[model samples]
Each structure stands twice: as structure tokens, then as C-alpha cells.
Target: MIRGRHQEPAGERESGLADEAEGFLLAHAHRDQARREAEELCAGMPWLTTAQAEELTGHYVRRRLDVTRDLLLTTALRAGQLRQEYEARYAGLRRALLKRHAAGVCAVLVCVGGASALACLLAR
Candidate 1:
């Protein structure tokens, strides 16, 4: 029998699937928007022949998609960098909190011990 095989929990699996679906939908929407924008842009120029307008629209959509792809890639990279930075900051803050707590505990213990010793000596 395999021991300690790691498996994604059902909730996480479902969430992953949902995220994938959402990403797909978002990409579709972006493509549609880009196409619409291209059409709108070509519409502004009434002199273009039907074939030229279509060609220009196609070119515009392609360029928009390329720009969008590049922007998304850059944003993803920056998000990853930000995540790493935030994690590091969180870890540093956690360590500092723990050290402060330990120091507090030690200070309390020292004060209590000193007071107890003084009381005993005075009573003797």
C-alpha cells in the first residue's frame, strides 16, 4: 500500500476547476471585445472597401491579442513577484512577533522570580 500519497482535497480541486473555467471565459470575453473594438475602429473609416475593412479588422484583432498576451504575461510575472515579496514580509513579521512574545515571557518570569526571592530573604 502506498503511504502518505499527497492528494488535493475536493474543495481545492473544485476551486482549481472553477478558476480554469473562469480564465477560459475571461479570455473569450477579451477576444470578443478586441474584435468589437477592431470593427468599431474600421467603421470610423467609411472609405475603406469591404475587403480592406475586413483585412484591417483582422489585423487589428491580431495585434490587440498579441498586446493583450504580452500584458497578461507581464502582469502574471509581477503578481508572482508580489506574492513572494508579501510572503517574505509576512514571515519576517511572524518571527519578530514570536521573538517579542518570548522576550515578554522571559521578562515576566524574571520579575516574578526576583520578587519571590526578595520576599523570602526579607522574611528570614
Candidate 2:
């Protein structure tokens, strides 16, 4: 039977010894479960103490928090990088096209001015 595979949020409760995994954790685990698991693991071993159990429990909680923080930091970093890339692309498109529009307008104005000047000379 499986004992240690990660369970999904919805179906974790049902993945038991049937999975053929070793060292598998229970789904919907809690702090009390942690203490119970610690108790079970240390039942036959002589090296651990009450203080050690508390320390181990605290360590587990801290490690979970650390992993969560790392995931959030990674997601934030990726989002920031994507935002910067999009902004850069938009800025480049704006820069490339803006001057062309202005140049077209200026060219039209110059053509009209030259036509007016020619008409005035012809009338002279």
C-alpha cells in the first residue's frame, strides 16, 4: 500500500494503504495528528524525549511556513518579470509608431503650404 504520496485537497482523505506507499501521511492532517504521529514514531525508539518532540513539532511547522513563503515569493517574482516585459513591449510599439504619424501630418501640411505658395506666384 502507498504510505507517503502527496494528496490533493479534495480526495486526500481516501488515499490510504491502498496506494501501496510507504511513510504516507494522513489526509486532513492537523497539529494533533502531528503529535500523534510523533508519538507513534518515537514509541519504540529510545533516543527521543518530550522536549525533542516539541522541538520537532515546531520545526515541522516552521518548515511548512518557509516553503509557503518561498512559493509566494517565486510567484510574485515571475509576475513582476512578466509585467515588466509587457510594459517594455507596449512602450516599444508606441515609440515606433508615434513619430510616423506625426511625420505624416507634417508632410501633408508642407504640401498644402507649397501649393498655396505656387498659386500666389501664379496670380502675381
On TM-score, the candidate that comes out on top is 1
lDDT of 2 by residue, 1-124 (tens): 4589865655554565445353232222444465566566666666878788668767766565566568768999999999999999999999879989899999999999999999999999
RMSD of each: 2.7, 13.5
lDDT of 1: 0.94
lDDT of 1 by residue, 1-124 (tens): 2588878889998999999999999888988998899889888999999999999988988898899999999999999999999999999999999999999999999999999999999999
Which portions of model 2 show Cα errors greater than 4 Å?
A: 1-59
User: How much is the lDDT of residue 67 in candidate 2?
Assistant: 62
* Span of 10 residues, lowest total lDDT, candidate 1: 1-10
**The best candidate in terms of lDDT:** 1
Q: What is the overall TM-score of model 2 with all chains considered together? A: 0.47
Error of 1 at 82 (Å): 1.3
